[model samples]
Target: MKQRCVKPRFWVVLVGTLGLAVGCGKAPSPRFDSNLMVMDKYDISFEQQQDIANALAALFGTPDDPYVPKESGLDKDKIKLAAGPTKSDKAGVHTGLYREHCAHCHGISGNGMGPTAAFLKPYPRDYREGWFKFKSTERAEMPTNADLERILRHGIPGTSMPAFEVALVQPEIEALVEYVKYLSLRGMVEIELARQTSEELGEGERLPTTAEFLVEGVLKPQAEKWSSAETKLMPVAAPPADFGSPASIAAGKSLFYDVNKANCLKCHGTTALGDGVLNDYDQWNKDVAEFRTKADATLASLTEQRGKAEEDFATAVEALGADSALSEEERKQQRETLEKDKAATLKKLGEKERMLPTAMAYTLVPRYIEPRNLRMGVYRGGRRPLDVYYRIHSGINGTPMPAIANLVADSELPADLSEEEKAQRRQSLQTQRMWNIVDYVLSLPYEPGGELGADISMLGRERN
Candidate 1:
């Protein structure tokens, strides 16, 4: 395991105060340079590192010189900080509410690696990736502001996160949402800069170390995307007249298992226990194997490239001039252990001759997300009827969950063949189907053994 080091911010202050001179006044101080800072594992150059740091600081601000949003939605000046349990007038709703409520578990930086994060099961969400699990938008899109507010108000079930509905008012919740978005954008920009630096460094090209370019080229586009999340909203159509009826539930059950339709059983499993096919991967994980073919030949090529990169990463870490408490032998041993783990992973990959059929797979990249256990009755998206309706209509962004509404067009053809007639008929069918699915999903936990429709009959009867 890699050793975790707490950064020595005091040394940075001391040496920075000393005018960037340290060690008998002969050596140049590496305190201010993020690349030489002990926490940096990538070991980027001083100038580029400083530029990245400055860009982050300009957007997010430091713990002391905090950036308060004025035009980005929330009225910073109007925010009033709550002192203890004291109550203020309706107009003087608490400010710095996010810092007070969320910073402990989510961190001041909103990196999700807060002090209490270590103790939690299914760690606090790292918003830096700019991907939200529950939203009304399509895949790979930023969530609408309502999505964030709803999560804050209701909180996630069977998780450490708590609801702020009773504690915080409308304004406070709005402010927190805006602040979370700001942090998310700031982190994404930093990631973009790091990625750009790594690509250039790998190709032996000159790095773009300008903070202005970082803001203009990376941050602006993401900010605009965030601002436009509402535009991508999938409006939930009015449910059919017989919505939530027994017939609707029965129809929904049929659709759930239909191979070409909802087909929810593929990933959600026969029991909806999230124990379906084991070959699921999220958006990020999928990216790791982008160059992979259907066959296993790519494994050998990847292993070779991995070996070279492992050596380079080890060399870079060893060459770092940052302060460390570990002896040379300890660091060397850790590097060796990591290389061994990489080899093991590559060997496991080579064991599989062909990749699973894409149709049977959850087809996303990056982190692999487990299908939600429907029987648990724990919806990360709001559990309100409309919330479930929206999720069924729009699907969770950045996951295998797809919008049932969009799939209606391909499921059946309308009596009228005209384009306009088809669209109207499709929308009508989509709304009814979505409502029925929501009814069935919501009833799962209440059924015997959490079974639904025909599956309920499969439960063993007591034999006398």
Candidate 2:
């Protein structure tokens, strides 16, 4: 392992007071901020929080000097290339790629609380959750290495994550990918440790810090999930003969509207305008919604209190004016005192309001998930038929969208056929149905809005 160290000055400024020194020496080492949000969710005690933080540092070193275990199967050299301060060596090799490029939005810990994160419409991903929205794998499976690489190369449409294809070479992209895995693995381990120490262990007990226990019980399982993603890629069969034909589109339109089937219209809306469902939260936001709701309630109560205070002040001022025995000087002096007290009360209330959680305060601000506006013809995940196929096949992970891959179950298969034949028939039917839906989605942009039948017939005539 390479042992080059740079001053952690950049991190100290970027993270503000959140930084915790995990090392001690004449020279200070850069630290990875503990996932305090996760620790707080589990109600981890301060002592237990320190234990978890120490274990994370031991397993995966600081941001400037990361340690990737062999069990993670991540490339150490690549991680080294991406870690540390953003500068070129004498030979001109780039290091600190993540800090230079990603930390502004994804944060130093990949917690998605970077400085510019609040301004974006759909916030950058919080990789700590180990859940990604776009991927070619099954719903619950980790995204394949190629999947992550593609996002780096192409970027998501209509989002702040820009493509790094033109700016960085292939090796640089690969290095960043490895670094992301390192951070994600570190985050998952932190969560597990917090849960185990807080819930499983007795009060005042610490998590086992041994390598054997940490690796077997905490880290290896999550690492293995990433390594095995290739095996879980959702199979995409060739499209049927009438795949993009008008007839196929018409069939797909029926499936899109059918509540028992794809029900694309329910979320995408009748005109594919993304106006159907407006109240759903994605998994990331959903996790933090409870906290946001609590803060919102506190804000509401404070507002009510302030209104009551204003009314009380007005009533006191009127009573002071109506006092019969008081001279003008006495009345004015009493009113001035009342004014000062009211001002103090309002100031205190204002301070409390400012301290409450707002969009700018959170690492991942809670936002409602909006279904895609198909009329715009912009797909966040690629517009290719196969890309759409994978989306409809596995569905977008960590969102309201659901997988339709199990359209044909064993019980629904023909009873007379042998088991092998029955399986083959089931596969064939599901593949064809998915393709039909894909065709309709692809044709949505160009098809003019009108009565449903008229639109279909018009599209069919144009194709014919």
Candidate 3:
């Protein structure tokens, strides 16, 4: 051909290859399109994707560090099998490593959350957070190795943390443990520094120690121990225990609604409905919350008001139709022709969140907490009903977890505590009842068999 546009052909190859790489076009350029193979979209490599998936899978695993040298005694770099810590510098190095590795979701100091924050729920702890919510062996504190291990071994089911027992080796797990303790210790130290650095009563005055992050009690051992590179992580103690008994459960039931125990009826109401069907402890308050000042709300009210709105919308739509008042038959014909045009004018009202909606999430009564129907003892949290029992016992932080720590009489219970001695015995029984009730509560959400509820794991229990 007559000097076949060699110049154009040369430029086509160069432009196709270089244009996508240099971002010469505007934003939303067709660079990501498979047609443009010059560069990879999202700048992510295949390896990185695998890593990200691995990282996500790890989250759903045990929430605790997996490595605590079993009787076999573990050390990776040194490979020495020993029960106690070998090197002290290793402790400090491990501490620093935790800040880089574990702190994000677990907290800047292993409190649960470092940088990958905001994207998680059951939100990361403050580290300076409380301990011993349920099935706790320690009076109250961050879990011992035993507690942490169970969480790590099984991984809280529904949560993002996953089990790592398979992917991570036992020795690496030990390294992680040392690292976590270091973070906890480091966090404790940071709190101390913050206090010491605070502009207190005077510039020179040292910040007095409260409970932790101080010289005396909490951080002292940590500091001394870390200095020696004491890699010895304390063993986590087993904390699980059984629910009280039938009598204790009955006692707990009384306290659940009664004034003596927690006096929950004030907010929860008599029938367990936020509605005060049994009595009026909070008549005005309930009215204020559920109150909607709009002109029409009830279905009866909607039945009255539907005509005008639909009629007006239909009138406008009829602009495209041959006849106006949209007869039933004609409307059905038009509906078949249009999809998005429907629901264009109907104004719907959704329940407004509380003035302090998030706050109310904590204060809500147990009835509103929304129990998932359980097919078996295994909850999304884990296999143990005791887990929920612990949650109930300790009460979830920051909200209305309803601390049944102290049992009381139900508002529904006969108000007849005539004898003080009887009351004391009842209180004792109520305490027991609290534990039983929790078990019963945990046992709930199981499928109901006839009038009786059956375990969902036994759903096939139905003879039919």
Candidate 4:
């Protein structure tokens, strides 16, 4: 089995420091800017872009000086603690926690386009989208504060995000969490404003930048979602008496391969090794795949044009060399002129290429999300039975893994049953099915060598 690679914390800190130093020596303190990609997607004009920036500044102040609105339900004190340049008081209380620890990978704007982002396989989270993978809440709901805090403390397995439990105190963790929420809220509002300006307003009409309009129309809705995340938590019921028994495991295996049931084999593979379908991308990559495709095509076209221009310049130079009728000085001047024109053409093409999305742009190149290799016994979310149950219950948000549903179809139930009774029966069966799958998943690591060894030997024989 191949071992998963995890970067050491010291290396992360070292690389992050070097990455951030590349952007140093700028005189002005950095400030959050409007997401240009979002604006471009909506075709927002420069004038409207300025208006959106102003509104965002008014709501959430600059990086050095943040302003969290009371309506946002964010802690102003915590935001202050996490914002600004990295420093500590004489007493050793840390300030600018996010910049010091997170900004190198997550970016100061929380857009996940920091200096070192491109080097990572799975890029850092862009807080702007508000879609989190591991959470206790339902798919459509925001993650609870506890959910975010747990990730911060334990970190994620097999990812660049490191555990901060021993490094920082609990209060520091809380401050970073609040600051993340602030960035997420600010980004969500910016996206909403861009959508309204592009889709709802007239061609020449400007977006309303008033606090009342923004708070009432845009900010409140997103804030309420964050505020109510805990209430939307998916409840996990206790497992049955024979939860991890052999009988339960056998039932889970049966369900795993059943076409109309869990059907886990489809993506997880016949051996529960993640070697099935390899083409699916997660929601984040899917969101920008179309834009990336268009950008790539434009880049290819420009590259071809540049190649032709170079060839043409070479041909013109050759023709000039053969002009025996011209004086030496005239030939030299003409060659210089030709060189200037070629330089100008190349410069224009370079500018257009730079304007398109690159490695450091808002969105990274789309990557296929690999399903979990259960044989390795590594669960990115968590390893506990409850954690596995939550995964099977609500599904990992923003991934292809779907929530367990429709276990007991209406037609399968008694025809004379009331609507509520049918719904109750469906819920009961779905809950049991989820637990069964959870049991099977947890048992994979301890399965007899005969079962797993046979699969591996068979694969080797076929390859030979």
Candidate 5:
């Protein structure tokens, strides 16, 4: 296993505190002739590398960081992990998800400039502003990756972020974090250039921007750094539990219905077939109706809504008039430039429609007719643990999936409490019966299997 050493904070001046500098008292940072502190902070020194290794001992911790614990998400473990999965690979998987699902709103670069970004609110985490809120107040003062995982699983109430665990597994959700971190880091670098240009050229002239600088210098270095980390973190695929053990399958069955835990049967049903109870629609339908009634469900409506908001913000700025007057000429010019970005963002969304795979997408509806049963995930929209996790947290926005974090955190459970928590109690009961029921369910369909035969691959041809 490659040893992990944390990188020093690249933006040293940004978080400039020297308390950890060990005996290096309140000395001011030595002046640089022309060097920017952000770039210089990254210079790798042997001593600094040692410091990073020490700092990361919690992340690359002795046994593990309890703040963010890890476990086998596999149904039955077959592959043995030596050092455990690295953070980069886990994040890369989510990067792919962004490419598939989120890039439309979050943008490939996560700059809140996705094709649909102009239409969204709070404008997708400008990622460049790397101010993450989920921090630990504990004396140790570090947040776990698990906290991120929880947010992914339960959508934050009153916001746009959605729960995603149902669609992503624990490892896959980990992958999303790495991808976001990559984008966030990139955004930070670009924002630095913006800050510099705004200062240097006095905000009139656009500063130096080079295709080569973007492609060859910045993008290439980042890819190299990230890909190297990814290869080091690729996790071993887990092996299935020994099928013949009987006891293992029995345990898995018990886990399903054991209650107080993964009460999957509530939505999945007792037959392990889609026969279980499902949650009733809550306020989602009403919200969708109200939203669509006033605003079109199509992308065009969202675009219009956002455009109006921008125009309003501009008007508000203009209304500052003499109350907060900028010189007349300066105000006019700033207004023009501000309008350009708003227009650009809106135009970006309209153009993305051309990229939609209308032909292949529609043709695939019934095309080859592959019968892959993926009902284990009933969320319908997604099929991975991370998908479910994100869905729960982010909610369906206009849908019934409410932001569970706020509800649970603030006891927002309606006093009406749908069905008086019928699903909760049902879920608990189902969990209690999980493992044994699954064993029996699987056994019911058993036919002799090859090689290991009756005890092993029960439903297949026997071994010669």
Candidate 6:
């Protein structure tokens, strides 16, 4: 199977199909301008929008007169226009749970640009992109149905996304998941159709079979992704003996900073400050080169000021004459080499300025993400050793952190080993190294200056 690499540009394909055309027939839905839509970028005019909208209407119908994909294998019972808990008093009175809880942030169309999105710091995730940040699946794979349900149940710890398990019943949560997928699929189809239409227009032609193409190209592929998501999980073997011993941690620490191995120091920094550089972008800030440029300029300006200060100090010492320990000529010479003898105190101040918050803004939008400072002992994922293992084995799905164990290769295997045996041996070696990494990471926060040379116990026991 050919692997699909999702481009960030694809995530920006916005859909404006709210069934409004520009009349009082129904109020025009407010347009989302923060994101770039395919229709706008491809110069898809009002006529083109209507053409695609009409084609979609013929296939999916309008909100007032909906067209459900019952024939396409979608469960009729699960498909719904609304989702939420029952209104109470009546035993079977179900209200729009999604609207009541999620719409304000997630938006009515699941575009992720709700009215309140402006006030949020990280901003609500635009689901139209279909790029979920957290998942158990491998990189670039769509999250499984269970993954979505888990998020809805557990909620993201650091964001405005709340846990719905306490507020809604299991059935309600399941229904909402269906609705979310439905909206997501609808948005994807809208973008796909727009893209197909744009291509046809470029060639001075028309799509041969709009409906059939949509069914095969957009609907089937996305549904298959949902179905196959659970299958992409990275397998793990049982941990090596004495996995949490001090020796294991020592080995793990070696691997963590090993330039040829884990290479964690490249991003996590030597002191675990999340300041490592790759292509001038660290985990916390994009386009870090821009910030570094400004810091450098600031340092240059401070250096010039320090030169004047040195001249002033020399003059003051010269006036002291016999009262001072040095002669006037000695004082003048010492001032010229202020930075030679002792530490260049001025450069130290400049470095301190780089660590300040004001100097770290890398982009116009306040987007800032730093690599995890392991020493803080704050992990969004659970604090158990197993959680760290899962992160190492699978990697954070949408971040720079990679599946470290998956990239390792065991060199001494038999030349003609069977595929099964090879897989078993690989898993064994990978799991052993991963356990070492987990042990070392768990020891990070307690290690002074993020040093891992000390013999220490794993911070938490493995759940597995």
Winning candidate number (TM-score)? 4
Clashes of each: 12, 0, 48, 0, 69, 5
Clashes of 6: 5
Runs of candidate 2 exceeding 4 Å displacement: 1-30, 294-360, 405-420, 451-464
Query: What global local distance difference test value does model 1 have?
Result: 0.60
Tens-place lDDT digits, model 5, residues 46-110 = 23223322322222132111112121111111111111222235444222354554555665445
lDDT of 6 by residue, 220-284 (tens): 77666655767886565677887889999898888888888888888777755555653333232
Off by over 4 Å in 5: 1-253, 261-264, 277-328, 338-442, 446-464
For all predicted structures, in order, the TM-scores are 0.65, 0.78, 0.41, 0.79, 0.26, 0.65
- lDDT tens digits by residue: candidate 1, 1-464: 65434343333332112233333424431222221111122434444555567655555454433454333333343233421223445796545565678877876556665777767754576676688877777657888888888889988876788989998888777777876786677666667767667665553355454645655666676677788888887677777888778899888877877877788888777776665665666553453345233222443566575566667666756654243876878777876766776665554443331222221131222345677777767777778777788777666765677766354745488565888888888878877887888888887766565354335333311100
lDDT for residue 149 in candidate 1, whole number 0-100 = 86
- Backbone clash pairs for candidate 6 read 83-97, 84-97, 284-369, 284-370, 375-445
lDDT of 4 by residue, 232-292 (tens): 9898778877898888888888887776888777887777776666789888788778767
Best by lDDT: 2
Better of 2 and 6 by lDDT: 2
Instruction: List pairs with backbone clashes in candidate 2.
Output: none
**lDDT (0-100) at residue 448 of candidate 5?**
30
**lDDT, residue 233, model 4:** 89
Clashes of 2: 0
Candidate 3 structure quality by residue, lDDT tens digits, 1-464: 44332322122222113233333233221110011110111222223223322322222111222222222122333222211222236444322333333455765334443455446543444343223222333223354445555655566664566565774456545556544444444444433333334323352344343433333543464444433332332222232254445554444456656676555444434422232233322321232234322211333355444565567656756664656677878776676544333343233311111112222321212112222233234344355645654555554433344445455445534567556766766665554554555655443334245423332224333211
